[model samples]
Target: MKKKHHRVALFAATGVAALLAPAALRAQESGAIQLEQIDVSGGPAQARTAGATAEKGAVGPIDARQLLPADLQTFAGSASRVSSQDLANQRPLTTHDALRNVPGAATVSDDGYGRHSGISLRGSPFRRSRKVLVMEDGVPINFSTYLDAGTHYTPPMDRLESIDVLKGPLVNYGPLNNHGVVNFRNLSPFGPKETVFSAGVGSTEGADQRVNNTRHAHTRQTFDNVGVVLSYSGLNAGGSWDAERLGYDDFYGALGIRGDNQDLTVSGGYFRQRDRYDEDNFSGTLADFKKYRHDKKRAAEAGHFPVSCGRCYEWNTYNADYFRAQVAHNLHIDSKTTLSTRIYGNHHDRARFYVSDDSDNPPSDFVMEGRDRLYRNYGADSRIEFADLPLFGGVTHTVQAGLRYEEHFFDNKNRLGSTNERLDFGNRGSLDGKQKLTAQSFAGFAQTAIQITPTFSVVPGVRLERYKISFRDFDEPGNDGHSTYVQALPMLSFAWEVAPTTTLYGGYHRGLSPHIVRDVLDTDTGYIAPKKEIGDNLQIGVRTKAVRGLTFDGAYFHSDIRNYQFGEAFQSNLGDRVFSSLDKARFDGVELSARLDSRAFTNSPWNVYGEGVYTFVNSKIVRGTADGGVNVAGNEVPESMKHTANLTLGVEHDSGLDASLSWTYRGSFYTDALNLPMNPLDVEEGKVKGVWLLSARASYKVTKELTAWVSGQNLTNEFYVSDRSDGAKPGVGRTVMGGLTLKFH
Candidate 1:
């Protein structure tokens, strides 16, 4: 039944695209629309070309209005961008690797492929990146941003054109924007004809002798007014421990049509993964980490490396299937007015098979338990931009307004089975629990940039959001519950051009985050619907390029968070997670990013460059209650690292040879609100020690069509623990990968 429903939604999205193409073709007969001119700061000139028409006299075309500005320097917010060149130089193995350069982002890897990882920003706790808003080409990607905003899937780095991180006053984004927003810009379908293929393989240092392979193929072509793009990325890898493996496949395609005054783009993708890498089975205690930190062979022999039990690895598994489709259209009403609209839908299915491991049960005991979860959503967003408006004397205003509608559906079921049975609905044992949840939202926002003076601007925006959430428990009819929420979020910002090459910016915004469905409405004793999370955020930043060969950016920010949420692990059964609401917290931080190239000062063939990102934050609970009814008002928030930094140095020659090295550091942080020094029994309450990793990459262009590269991560072979949410999860050891790419027209 679920598969049938998925096909219907997929077909419906495709049908919408099919209908829009004919209308776009008919618009070709209309008169040409006057083009508007705007200057873009950096990156490729035709970065976002699918739904955009080239301006008459602009440096580059405008973005699709995906919340952030095309010119990052003029925006009155703190923003960080990673370009295609950076990706090429780094040769990252996962999405987290590509995001290492972004300041204020704390990335934790629980799986070798980054399929299950954590990304925390500001003072947000790192748990599958629930606090951050993640998007792909301006569309929200989380299964349910309001009900359950957890990261289950992230687009492979192979298909990304660029990455943008935005902070401060994001009125155009959503309820999960309390920390910030991360956007992955996809490659444009309307590009020059070309085909590219790459393949790579690597091995990590361990007694298990695990190896991993990666492959990617991308091709695109333009035929007059029509263009099409197709791409695929695949990965097969070994996990961090013995008897575990991971594999995934991703497929994507796009069709674009261009008219005289309008453009339309339709894109779709399917991703699937099956793995035996369960965090519960992969994690161990602190004593186990210390014993096996350096020697995998001895630890394996001791039967305590992963766990004392021997049969845990064979029975744990995870699987996921995700599908998404989107249609985007842009209309040039006039030279100074335009409209952009996007309709998108996605379906995701996930299953995890796990079992109990205790002292009473034997290692070979077959009592299997699992959870099957399904999430689907459909949304439509439309916005209009009015540029170069003469609103008042000596003042020009650029106004933007938009409306959005979204509906989400989530279904979860718990089952128990024998060891011989698979995770099939009929084959799996009896159903222990069943739930169906839904969320519907209606939102509208408007923002205006008032250029009162040639070198100064002020932007004010507000968003009104209305949402309804429903929960139903099939097992227990009395547990059914529903709630409705209405919120008004406001934002104000200003940018002043202190110098021709420098800009000073500041912003203030009110943020909101709704409660997750399970925490608010569940079959638990003494259940109380917790208040929604709210925050008041303020930030001041500066961007400067006054130095001939350097660019610098710095920002200071503060956030007063109310009703902060924390996830407590191992509170009941082993590896189980429970969410609790704390009273209030405060976060203060400073972010810095800078880059310099020696070639800018010296006209030489070799360009020596350096880039760095550093962040310092202090997160403390001003008023809160910890577990056991303890008053922990002055404790530090869990997983709030005080300092994080990444630095890179590289040299590039005109002959297409480049080499770079990067060093990343993460500061120590507490694991619970009680601020315990250590707890050997639970192993989830303690201060996690800090660690540093070093990576290096070198590439050479052997010919016009062939390029080769090699990279190494964790060159020092550090023995460190990356996370302790469930238990002590060790970080990846030293790894070396090499690949070759062939490109041709």
Candidate 2:
């Protein structure tokens, strides 16, 4: 009966897609827009095609209004983009949801709102708090201290104004540049300065409510600029799964201030988030005697055993606080010299807790665990440009240099005890541990662009980096260690303006991601060893705006990775121990995207727009010590979908009414290292079929200051598996949400 219900729901969603296909095709035809000319800055016009400097007319210092109507920066490269308009339109409750449209991205959820969420990019081997880099307003958030248990926390999405994502290890001006980079650009203090407030309520597992208020004020008479934003949310409800467990609640807030002068700008902010959740354990197969009988018929036949039928409750909590400040200054030393310097500092404190079997049914055992981690980071970066140099045909050149330093401290403690003291079986004890780690690095790069002709240009560049890591454990001696590594990255590229509407470009570069505290820490000995990863990537693409209202961009890329980090499981008489290992991997893929903006009727009130993206990836493990040297060379990388696509269609009018409908689909994927067969929980074996998601939203203006909107997501009530692992169940079923917005200036 359960299988039949699942089939019925799948068929219904397919029917809806067939019904909406024609309308989507028509919308695509009416809303297409031609691509615009790209602006190149800093380096010679020819060098813009290379990685030398940003394009001149490119949208620097993003603005809110420009985010609408599709901008070139979003499509400049195969990677890197953040659409403020999309964020406003989607109003995602979590950061993971906001990144659903990015290329080569996937997310897994441990719970609602504030549970564990993990992301995989371009088939990187990192998982469960490893390898990835996250930053808040240019400040590194990862601790440099020794191996820590809890390093995977992000600020609430509501406090962020934009998110910038870079898919592979790329050299950026900051610490913690590992597998990928995600920069959370918080709301800045600028503009006319206004006060805005909003409140909302929704239904999911239960009831939810949120309120947000912000004040932006500035005084020209004073040399100081200040801004503050505060928000609060509450959730009290039942969950969709099991129907017996309750949901969780989360609260977060942020405050920011800034000051600016003719050649300098300084800003700082503070943020905090608190979360609580009820944990749910995974149920094994029915054959296992310890498994709880969720089936009603089985319970009845067994005479309703209370211990095996009752629900269990677990409690978990997380609290985090972060503060950051940065300064940027422009320097003028010579007629042809332009330079800029930036420096920043960041500090964070985090605490987490977990409690199992809170009710202690059947006098079962209960356990509690907690951890605290603190981190501090500092960095300084500068870029200089020298134009019309006589060294090479009077070509232009740019030099970039930077230095970064970080300090981290991790203190972990765990205690276990039974619900009843009489049942204490020698398992009740406490363990305390502490570790410290530090990282320091310096980098220098130089690139020059040569203009050979009016229509063609070439640029070449190279960068050198030196990194050092040191670790020490206060609780254990003989665990102190230090390691250092140096690397050089070179890049070259060329661009040709073949026609007024066509541009052809290509480039090749080297990248690296260094191992940190987590890579070296031995769970038993509390000792760690440093590891490093290096890779090279090649890319070629063509961008065109041939038609009057249609623009397209496509790219092909291949990356070779050496010394990749992986986890290995070992069994001992004491227990099972998992340690980090080194392996080699490779990733290759293609991506294509297009946007169309058009007006069907010159005088009509209806205007249509459409945007779409398609990605194809093939990632594999080339060499590894396990598997008897049998290469799993052709298998698709774990968690990376073979193909993914999204399409959006909308209509707008001059009268302040806008409506849009969107569809997204993700291909089947694997979830484990071995890609084993015959396992129901194996993502690669069960093969979660592709799903079509449909959402529609519309807005109506009540007055100049207020506007109300009604939106529905997953209207077809599609039951799809967003993520799955060895023993974890997929995400919840269909969800529906609505909201309203107001402006006061």
Q: Report the C-alpha displacement of residue 691, candidate 1, in angstroms.
A: 0.7
**Per-residue accuracy of model 1 over 583-665 as CA lDDT, tens digit each:** 89899999898999999888799999999999899998999988778898988888788998999999999989999999999
Clashes of each: 0, 19
Evaluate residue 439 in candidate 1 and report its C-alpha lDDT on the 0 to 100 scale: 84
Write the residue-wise lDDT of candidate 2 on 646-737 in tens digits: 77787777777778777866666654345544244322133344577776777766777666666555567554444443232334434454
Error of 1 at 727 (Å): 1.2
* Candidate models: Cα lDDT each: 0.74, 0.48
lDDT of 1 at 685: 54
**Cα miss at 333, model 1 (Å)?**
0.7
**Cα misplacement distance, residue 745 of candidate 1 (Å):** 3.4
